[model samples]
Target: MNGSSALTLAGVLVLLTVVAVVIRPRGASTVDFYLAGQRVGVATNAWAICGDYFSAASFLGVAAAVYATGLDGAWYAVGFAAGFVPVLLFVAAPLRRFGEFSIPDFLGRRLGSEKVRLVAVGVVQVVILSYLVPQAVGSGITWELLVGSGLLGLSPYATGILVSTAVVAGLVAFGGMRGTTWTQAVQFLLLLGALVWLAATVVGEGFHYGDAVADLSRAPLENPAPDGGLTSEQNALHPEEPAIFGQPGARYGGLGQFALIVTLALGTAGLPHVMNRYFTSPTGAAARTTTVWVLCLAGIFYSLAVMLGTAAREIVPTAVDDHPWLADLTVDGVLQVPEHALPVLGRIYGGDAGLGVVAAGALIAVMSTIAGLLLAAAASWGHDVYERHINPRATQRQAVLAGRVTTLVTACAAAGLGLALRPETFATATASIVATMVTWAFAIAGSALTPVFLLTIWWRRTTAAAAVAGMATGMLVAVAMFTAGLFAAGGLLREALVTPTLVAAPLAAAVTVLVSLRTTAPADVEKSWLIMHGTAADRHAERLAQLVLDENRRRRAGRRARRARG
Candidate 1:
């Protein structure tokens, strides 16, 4: 990249840092650090949720998947975005009304069981770590591809991982949730803008997305199927297939795979980082509004991404030897490094400067996501572990310090994992692995915690023992499935065992309900339901809004009075 381009990228990062520092919450209190004092507005919270939800997976991974696999790659986008719809309808509002600092905290209070809280903390930590490692790997990979040189004798991959991780850790440590929220919201908008701009430029080049797709479809798919149909592999590996559709694989399949889609779509409500965002909103109404905005924005972003992927398919010939830069990167012209396709496309259209902007956007996406995950990790550890178990008498400042320390430790661990597991390339492989690891976490949360949470707020017969039993069974089943998948050889057995949530979640819920039926409901169940479902929090949020307005009016009146006196 040119020095001017490098400078532009550096300037953007510095500006973001400064803005975050300026808005950093002004207290060391756990509430302020963890939840931004619960004062974020709906629109801002929505953007931050986007930032948190759309990680390296959404930015580089989804685009790369589309670039490599064609229409098959679009499945990732569909699965990811569709997951949010369930979250908005079934999870968001009540989660916000629960008003807990973290998922574990919410479960602990509602179920009235510290054991359940600990179990939740353990599950959440595992999910966060699983999700964090891939993001670090992505940053390293992008850095190596974007800038040929590594900083300070470090490999470009290592440098990328270190720098990006450190920057995010510092952001979280200094700004806490308040600063992180504003920065994330802005960052997501920039990401969306980058996507929109790229899409417009690609279209302006006289490339019609629909036309391109039709052309691609007319070509023979490369891979041979069980029934002699084409597969993605055939299309990607064999260039002999007509260049229109590029390659052919399963465009659509039986209901079994459809079940996987259903699992993912319903699973979004269970993700830790996503659920954590709901608590940051001031009220249930704000949370609902935020989800609505997220749905619209996410839908737009994913649609454009799918279109861009199609354009790349049409514009960039499959033969790597045909392109100058691509020849150097991929031996066979098929993108071995799936992440490189989007950046390469950026350069092809906008030259070196455009590549720099796109590369920088990828970095920002990783950084924003890492910051959110680290904070979530810190909250789970510090609040759920140190304060709740180790030192019930710990002060708020002490708890905040613990959380910050945990954030640093978690970041380091993720960086180390990324370095050690330097995979040859990241494609759907990385994404699938990350998704699989968290799938169980979501299942457990949805089946066990979510049920208890809902029932506590709606039904009057949810007991503490039942919640504990439900969470334990959910955790056990999720772990068993994960272990079986990891240890078992590839085949139908593995696929069935690997996605345990499809089995475990329902069983967990069943156990919880069955157990609860035999026990007496907690006396506080009705009162808790009133708090969780009633509009007290919404009313409080409205009152807070009025106070802000009134304060602004008084300030204006005081200024006028001063002017008259003068």
Candidate 2:
């Protein structure tokens, strides 16, 4: 990009960083560092949740999926948005009420078992690492494409990976959750703004989304089919598919594929980084309200992304000879990189500067997500591991320091993994696989933890043993399925094995109920239930409102007194 463009992007990023760092609450307490002192308002918390949730996967992968697979690509957005519904109904309020630092902390406390906590921590770490690496990789890919900068003979990909990793690590280490939360919330707004602007511009340029879809539907899709060249049979199955859009059924088929979608949608409630955001809110009600906001924002963003992807398919000819970038990268005029479609659209509308903006946005999306992930990892390691396990008597300052160190270490590890994996696949493909892998994490969390959490808050008879057994079984099944799918060849068996949440989640819930029925309930279960589900949160909300009013009244009174004295 040009100097002015680079400066513009840098100026925006620096301004955001300043706001995040300066506005962070002054305190080094563990609660402040990890949960923003649990004082984040509903609207800010909602935006931060959106920032955490809308990773590189959502920003790039959704559009790329549509660009590559036609209408079928829209399923990613559908599944993603649908996942929040279950979360709102089942997980949100209860989790906030549970009041824990991390998922493992919540599980450990709820079940009253240190062993359960340790096991949950291990699983949560694995999930975070699995999810984190690909985001780092995405950051690298975006930088490489946008800046075309190669340092020390390194490719743009390597440069991107290093820069993003360092930046995110620094942000987390210095600002912690207080800074991270505000930064993420602002980042979410920027992402939404960018998408809205791009969408409007594209529409203004006469790119009709509905007409584009109709036109794409009427053409033949020429894609890389499993058995080589697109056969007549494949075309017959996807008659309405356009040449730019891949053939239907070429991706996957039957119940197994549907299971993937279900797993992803249902599994979202369980993600540690995502679930942890709820804890930042002051009360259960605020968490619930935040989720409602997230649902609305996500729905709008994903819908626009889907439309943009469809627009790319309609506007950009499949044949590379027709476009400038395609000739440089494609063989025989066919585009190979699916991820480039969105950037290409930006270039077509806003030229080089627009392309840089979208690319920078992609980078910001990754960085914001990585920052959240790192914080969650820090909480898991610092609070759950070091403080709880190694040094029970450690001071709050000690815990915060440990979290900062862990954030640095985790970011470095993720960067190494990103570099190692950068050449293996395209950014879009890697993002999907990472997202899919985390599906098991979500499933286990939703199935095992969500039920126990809900019942703990609402029902009085949820035994500790039931909670322990449920989380254990859920984790075991998800791990087994994930491992089996990794080794298994591409087929029906693989699809079934790969996306285990569809099968494992239900099984986990069943075991939890059955085990609870067999075991004697904890004596404190009723007390805990009341604490979790009672009106304390409502009372807290009323108190906060009264405090705001009182403050405002005092300010006005002070002004009157000063005037009278003068």
Candidate 3:
């Protein structure tokens, strides 16, 4: 590694360590450890959620997709940003109002069924693992590109996976949700700052966005082929046509595009890590406000990402003559690993320092996301499973220990999977495999958990039996369709299978409705409804807080009067 680049990365890691240590949770209370005492502010939680949500996929893969596929790639950003709308309107407030450590905990208590809670735990783990592995893979990719060196006799990619997972796991295990939230918020600022700096640099260099798109569209799109050369790609939407960079069919057909959007848009509500952030809000209203802030922030971040991707596509080719090192990373002006688009652009503009900034941002993206996922996993396994089921009378200290252990184990598993599914294995298949991998998680979440989760909150008649049925059906259907998609040749069928949320979510909801009609609702359905939708608890909490503040003020005034008399 270059000394400057190494120093930049080490500096970022050290800063995160300091933050985690400084604000680390002190109590043995699981509430403090897992949910940060449910006192996080709207804007801070919004930033932390963005940090958790905008993983390597958002940081690296979105730009990679845009760089490789052009217009279709932009849809990823649009879909991701739009996904929060449903959450804001339907899920956010009620979810926070319900107030639980995890999705499984909420479902179990809401439905009054241990079976529902246990089953939900299984599904949550699946979603978390699905999300976690891609983050690990992203870390590996970033390390390979940024450092270009191995550690402990491993490949740079594998070393990246292990090191990142280990560090983030340690942070979550010790720091808990409070520390993770603070660090995530900071990490997101770094990510946004890096993007802004890169965008400004590119724009300053006399690059016009419209002219670049028009120029790129004038020629056929080509990418690095697996066989070490460039190849012209045909449009998947219209098989007879050559793909154009500015058009819609570079990577996905019309149906594929719609499927991708639907999957991501619906999936946001069901992501355990993201959903868990809602629980950290002090009130349901704060949760809703956080969603609004998240939407606005996401729009800005993604718009810049799309622009930077375009800049990379337009600028990288011209720089190859002057920067010979880039030639090895690219083939005939196109990146072999599409995820390298941003970092490569950074190098071209600011040399090693620019690349360091961008690379550090990528790693930050991976680690922050990993921290969220690990915490989610801990909540599910430790609080939901171990505390509730395995050891019902477990002490607060025991529960916290359980969570830490779960975090470490889950992180290790994700790292191992990342190494197995290394990027080079399918280097030429898609421009940004990380984004596609994340979409699979979206499909699973949208199909399984989201359908049942929404029905539980809105439909008073939604029974525990129906929830189990809906969740089981959604998970199985999504997994089966994705498995079939792996072998199918390209077309609408493949698109539907791979991005199965459009089919699976509706089917899951339908099953839930049908099953609920035949089953008895929970006996406390009305009570649960009041808890979920009523504002009484929020009002009470506000009054209690005001009383405490007034009391403190009176005590201060009395002390001042006594001092004046003396």
Model 3 root mean square deviation, Cα atoms: 7.7
Please, what are the lDDT tens digits per residue for candidate 2 over residues 1-566? 33357436744764675577667665789998999889999999888988888887788778876766675566678878888998888778877887999988877776677876786677677778877886876777677667777788988888888988898888888898889988898888888877888899889988887778777666555443333333221322333542335434534445554776787677677678898989989988899999999999989989998898778767666534455665554334323455666666776677667776677677778888898999989999999999998999999889889999999999888889888874334332222443443454555555555555555555566666777777777778877886787777656777677677777777777787898889887665544555566688665775687799999999999999999999
TM-score of 3: 0.94
Misplaced by over 4 Å in model 1 are: 1-18, 23-25, 220-256, 318-323, 425-459, 486-495, 536-566
The all-Cα superposition gives candidate 2 an RMSD in Å to the true structure of 9.1
Local distance difference test, each candidate: 0.72, 0.74, 0.90
Q: Model 1: per-residue lDDT, tens digit, 242-330? A: 42243333222233245345556655666677788889888888898899999998899888877877776667665344547765655
- Total clashes for model 2: 5
- Output the TM-score of candidate 2: 0.86
Judge candidate 2 against the unseen true structure and give its global Cα lDDT, from 0 to 1. Answer: 0.74
The 10-residue segment with the lowest total lDDT in model 3: 1-10
What is candidate 2's CA lDDT for residue 297? 90
Measured against the true structure, the TM-scores of the candidates, in listed sequence, are: 0.84, 0.86, 0.94
Query: Backbone clashes in each candidate structure, one number apiece?
Result: 13, 5, 0
lDDT at residue 259 of model 3 (Cα atoms): 91
Residue 360, model 2: Cα distance from true site in angstroms: 1.0
Give the Cα error of residue 472 in candidate 1, in Å: 3.5
